[model samples]
Target: MEVENEEPSWFVYLVRTSKSALYCGITNDLQRRFKQHQEGKGAKALRGKGPLQLVWSQSEINKSEALKTEIAIKKLRKVQKEHLVKQAVRFDRK
Candidate 1:
C-alpha cells in the first residue's frame, strides 16, 4: 500500500489590541483563534486586551513556516507592524 502525503494549512495572523498594539500569532484555525482572543481565552499576553481587530493574516503551507513567519512579524516594532497593516489595507482597497 502507498501512503498519501497531506499538505498542512496554517494561518499567520495579526490582531490589533485595544491599546492599538499589534499581536502576531499562528494557528491552524483562524476563526477559533480570533474567537479565543475576543473571549480573553487566547494568549495570556493578550488578556485584558479584548475586542481585538483582525488587522492582517496570510495562509501558509506548513505549521513550521507559519510559525517562523509569525515570529518574524512579532519581532517587528510597532511602527513596522502598523506599516504592514496599512499596506494590507491598501491592497484590500485596491
Candidate 2:
C-alpha cells in the first residue's frame, strides 16, 4: 500500500474582515484556517470579527518562505495590502 499526502502545499494568506480590515496569516490548509476563523478560534484580534473572507493567498515551496511572506505582509499598511491584493489579482488573470 502507498501512502497519500493530503496536506496542502503551505501558503501565506490574507483575510478581509467584515469591517474591511486585512489579516495576514500562514497555514498549510486554507479551508481549515478559514473554518477556524469562522468559529472564532483563530487569532485573538480576529475572534470577534470573523468569519473572515479570504481576500488573497499564495503558496510557497516551503515553510520558511511562507513565514517570510506572512511577516512581509503583516508589515504592510492597509493601502499597501490593497495594492498587493490588486497585484495578485492581476497576476492570476494572466
Candidate 3:
C-alpha cells in the first residue's frame, strides 16, 4: 500500500502571459516551474507564451490540495480569475 504524502510544501500559482492570459498550475518549486515555463518546457499551452509573470500563489498546502485548487482556478472564467488575482494581492500589500 502507498502512503499519502502529507507534507504541506506544495503551491498553486497563477501566471500571467504577455498576452494578458492567465494560467493556473500547481508546483512545489515555484521558481523551477517558472524557469521551465520561460524556457518553453513547462505546460504545452504556456509554450511560446513567453514573459510570464507570477501574479498569485498560495503556498504551504499539500499536493492534493494544490491539485484541487489548480482545477478550481482553471474552471473559473477569465473575469473571475482576474478578480482572484486582484483580491489575492490586496492582502499582501496592506
| Per-residue accuracy of model 2 over 1-94 as CA lDDT, tens digit each | 9987645488888888889999888888889988899899888879888657888988876787778778877776789889878787421211
TM-score per prediction, in order, is 0.82, 0.80, 0.81
Assess candidate 3 and give its TM-score to the true structure: 0.81
| Top-lDDT candidate index | 3
For residue 82, give model 1's deviation from the true position in Å.
Answer: 1.0
- The sequence of per-residue lDDT tens digits that candidate 3 reaches over residues 1-94 is 9988766698888999999999988899999998999999999989888788999888744787777777877887999889879888421211
Candidate 2: what lDDT? 0.80
Of 2 and 3, the candidate ranking higher by TM-score? 3
